[model samples]
Target: MTAAVLSVEKFTVSMPDATASTPALGLGQDIDNCVPFMTVSSDNEANEAQMVDVKKNGGTNKFDFTATALGARDLEVTVVEFDPAQVTIEEVSFTLGSGLTANVTVGTIVEANTFPIVYAHSAGDTTDGYDHVMMRATFTSTTNLQIIKQVHQADLVGHAYILEALNGQWSIETGASIPLAYTTAQTTKNAAITVTANRTGLWSYWDTSDIGDDPRDSIWDGVITDATNLDLTRANGSTPSADGDIESFVVNFAADVAVVQQGEFNYVTAATKTAAISAPGTLGNTMVVATNAYGWCESTGVTVARATCQGRMTFNSAIEVLGTRSGFGNGEYRQNFQVIEWLIGGAAAAAEPIIIMLGY
Candidate 1:
């Protein structure tokens, strides 16, 4: 007698949510959470000795059985969950035709591939049944495997079925044995400008250093420079005091990012001040009032440097006039304004600081 070789595919025997009634092997089936039994049969007399068993390997389960038959004949596999108290049962069956006559090839070799992630069929939280049961098994050749996840359970209906993958950072399944993986990465760079002034001075409006008769009033052109004996006064007609505190004003700033998106908090609230940003600069244009607002929300808790990086706020106007004319998504884009002015309720408040943020 010629023996047939067979290696069943991997599958998970999903247990329903119910009480275990029948004792040994849980195969007695008391209804609800009863164990399932499987049987293998074929037309050929040589196939009568075939034994089918489901084995648990880690998170996966496999069906094991004889692969080769004496001459050639069709084989039938049946699985059923029974309730010992009742005769009715939920059963399913499949037919595997003779290896010599069918296109499928049977083998005795142990063929199995493990996935990077472990898949769990049941949540095990409630006695409630599942929407469906998904199983992966190889019934054809050793190399060809088929996954079944859409099988509907008799008790579970209307609800959706899910296969939870717990192992990798990210999982992408295409109904295949192996799934794709994904990870996240990030980088940062500083863009704050620093400088010192030779004399105490007041900051004039954005573009021009001297807007009024007071040449002593000056605003840095959003440029960074360093030197000794720096004068940092910003109120017009203010005496040139040796206040080194003024020089320390524009020193610290956060690193600039390639992109900024809306954060979780809203821009404007009763307790917080709103901030604004402008587009980057182009060849002929500077950040001006006409620049677009690319942000979806307003700025809150904005500081002087952050508000400055965003753009200049008018004396009392709610809008922030960005210094750059260029827009976001440009080949190389950045915040347009290098310098900023602070004001409260339409009046300049050189003393009060603001907070700014660039969301990820």
Candidate 2:
């Protein structure tokens, strides 16, 4: 023999029509529209009972129990996902009338209305030949309708809508079927990328000789091909043939580059070179350094100038200086170095002096 246990498969609600006559439940007309309740994460029920105890003067326990207050039952439902089209009339700003066909969009105002609710259960007791079971509650009111919005995480649970039922007057019906039709949940995929026109000459850079000269004379125009790659060519769209011309350039993205997936390797390489260059100067001055260039203090008693090496700068007063290096394909590379400050006893010098050295 099969077990008689059953699971709640569907839950629905029917709004009351003011023009129609009340049913046997003494609430409203039995339209039986039975719209399927939207997606729900959890459904919980609570019951409270009120009673009075009677006892004799010499008795050790209560002799009798009596009902003193009205009983209360509540049903709480929470939905993490739902179908907007099916529930637009019921949940959004709309009103339902006699049948499901009479729904009207009433702007933003939602009326406080009472309705009937039903909970349909799965097939139970095959030997007894019962198809399914359903519980119908009349004169049910919705309370504590809360809308919760939170940060999205791994669960993919977006907005949550909670509904509470008060004044539970209900009955169970055997061998019942769901009346209304419901739409299956649809899968929404990510949008496709659209590129209408190609963007060229997005960026340009000048060489050492062209620093104060005409930019068009030595400018290397950069063209972006896609989201990850860029091409550098002469302003005239020709490859470099002579020396001192922009040879090849490459960009190596770090492991944690923004918008790119982690652990994925991405890089762009251009040409070849024989030697790298480095020039040191004070702050606010552009200084180009080759990859892996190191700066250090050589001697004391000399005012050390603040030099912008690559894209980094040295400390104001320190025995050793370490900075970031550019010109490499890699972006924003850093090498850590210990800094030691010198403190001499005796009278202090008018200006702290230190020698700066650059090495490959």
How do all models score by TM-score? 0.14, 0.13
Model 2 poorest 10 in a row by lDDT = 42-51
The lDDT values for all models are 0.19, 0.18
Tens-digit lDDT track of model 1 for 1-360: 111101111111211111101112212222222212221222222111111222222122222222222222111211122222221222122222222011222223222211111112122211111112212222234332222222222211111111111222112211222211111110111122222221111111111112122112212111122222212112222221111101111221111101111101121222122335432221111111111111111121111111111222111122333222111211111221121211011222222122111111
lDDT of 2 by residue, 4-107 (tens): 11111111111111111111111121112112122111111100010011111113211111111222211111111112211121222111111211122222
Which residue segments of model 2 deviate by more than 4 Å?
A: 1-212, 227-230, 236-243, 247-249, 260-360
Runs in model 1 deviating more than 4 A are 1-50, 53-91, 99-360
Residue 126, candidate 2: alpha-carbon lDDT: 12
RMSD (Å) per prediction: 33.5, 34.4
lDDT of 1 at 113: 15
Error of 2 at 140 (Å): 81
